[model samples]
Target: MPRVADGSIPGGPRHVALIMDGNGRWAQQRGLPRTMGHREGVRALKRTIQAAPDFGIECLTVFGFSTENWSRPAEEVSDLMGLVRTYVANDLKRLERAGVRLRVLGRRTGLPDDIAAIVERAEQTTAHNDRFLLQVAFNYGGRADIVDAARKHLDRVLAGETGEALTEDILGAGLSTVGAPPVDVIVRTSGEQRLSNFLLWEAAYAELIYQNVLWPDYGPEALADVVTQYRNRDRRFGGVESATARVVG
Candidate 1:
């Protein structure tokens, strides 16, 4: 692991979101099954969850499986679903030991009953953990999130709840990540430059980082590099840069 002299990320983001990409590509390049790359990605996820707090991040959200991914070949999708089951079965206790809270943010209408039960149990088991919150955006899409929130809000309005405020806070409450903090930095691995429908609302003013390394290969060193790059940026947030802007711990 790369260590900073100060033992923290300078100007580190409070909330970091990762679009973990390139699993299939990584497998293709290595002449292996895509499932193998996904398995490695899971290992990388474990490393990231363990290292995130040390880097000064309070919240971490990963784009684990997108709704669009269901369009892939049936065998691959099944494999991915199996991977999710395996992850929950194997990592629940370890995550609890690390004080990591597991949160899943997505629609679960079509998910298998057993998998949904596993997700619910994992969440319940880690609800009281305070060290870090890890949100997995499984079967998630940014546009879908917005639409769902809007529909929920409309439903409330239709139920004789008149004059209800429709502010950002209200809309945010209706979204999957209802109480989570906004994302401050969004990182996409595999050299991808697009958001690909991840955290559209929360990441409005986030610092974006792109890495050439695939998700399976991303580790603590890569995370440190992203934080270093973030520290070097000028985040004006639509305002004039502060004359005496300084990095935070």
Candidate 2:
């Protein structure tokens, strides 16, 4: 219930999106296989999920794989696929046990059948849990998501729904994260400053923070540090402070 000096809400972000980058670089720097870095990055994600509730963040959306990642070397792509399989096989139960709702976003048409099945199973297993939300963006791209939403919107218009009117709220509701709040903070590891086609629409007003540490090195302490930065920001939503400025001055 506390208000910031600028009369803005002073609290932790409700939704946090993480761009987990630099896995390959982390492995190369240590003369190890790139897969090893990905393995460690998954561990980092586990630690962050365990620590997210403590930070009061309701939703945690992570960029695991992008649509463009398919262009990587075949061997590396296969390694990534195997890592995802292992993580789901071994960690699905752990996530469900912790009351974390799982949602896998993006296209699945080209994925292997078994892998697709596992994705569905994970979502079904934790569908009822409401304590926390974890969105795994596999094969996801921001432009593609917007295109998909636009197509769905067209269907409604052709059906004579509401005089064919279109609005931001209506279009956003058609995306994968229909019921969720907008992204509040976007954290990119390995010092990446750009969105890289991850959650472009949802991150319209999110506070962007680029960390120098690689994805594998990001842990609970790093998450806490970034969250502290979020809490200190003055979110005015394009409005300037009026009475609060006079009172604080």
Candidate 3:
């Protein structure tokens, strides 16, 4: 692709997703508790949110806690839940003031009552904001999301909502990320290369970038580097090459 005058690609990704990994390893390397690493990771999340708009990203999604995480030690699970409460209590006001709509994508049925309340409040409070979107995937799994979406479609059909058959659009609209844009790029930290059941359907055409930096160490520079790599990717989306691709090839 030809570079723009500013030495950057024009019309950069509008949506970026991240798998923030290596927190426990980062703390273990420092002889600190894993919880400490999680705290620092929260700081990195704040920095990323502040920097995303600068890169022309309108929506940022981060995988926080996964459904499979419940199998970890009880203490760690409790700590993770605590972190969710603490993050919302500390950041909700600032996030609302900054016009960042926060959407927690995951199953709510199994969430603790208090944490569920906080999630509801955060989403309701910022429902009117439109400046940016921050989607946190907590207690989420890509396979589970797909199952939930399928159930939703089946329920509608049983309720006689429509006689039409299920299609991609129909199923997609039933996903937790219903109104959100398709992910443009998915970045995994700590050099991990797997999706880890994050955004399965939404990432069908996303550019995947892996970074060696640990989650606590991630910031604007790391994301910027990811975007740079994303720019060089030739995204064909299962179609023929574009005019730019032909010229560059």
Q: How close is each model in CA RMSD to the real structure?
A: 2.5, 3.9, 2.8
| lDDT by residue for model 2 (128-227), tens | 9998999999989999999888889898788877565778987898888777767889999998789999998988778898999999998888888887
Tens digit of per-residue lDDT, candidate 1, span 1-249: 354685655567778899999998999999999889999999999898888888888899999888898899998888888988998989899999989899999988888898789889999999999888999999899999999998888888889785686788788888898778778889999998999999998888888999999999988998888777777778877889741274442
Least accurate stretch of 10 residues (summed lDDT) in model 3?
Answer: 1-10
Cand. 1 TM to true fold = 0.93
Best by lDDT: 3
Pairs of residues clashing in candidate 1: none
Candidate-wise lDDT, in order: 0.87, 0.86, 0.89
What ordering of candidates by lDDT runs from best to worst? 3, 1, 2
- lDDT-best of 1 and 2: 1
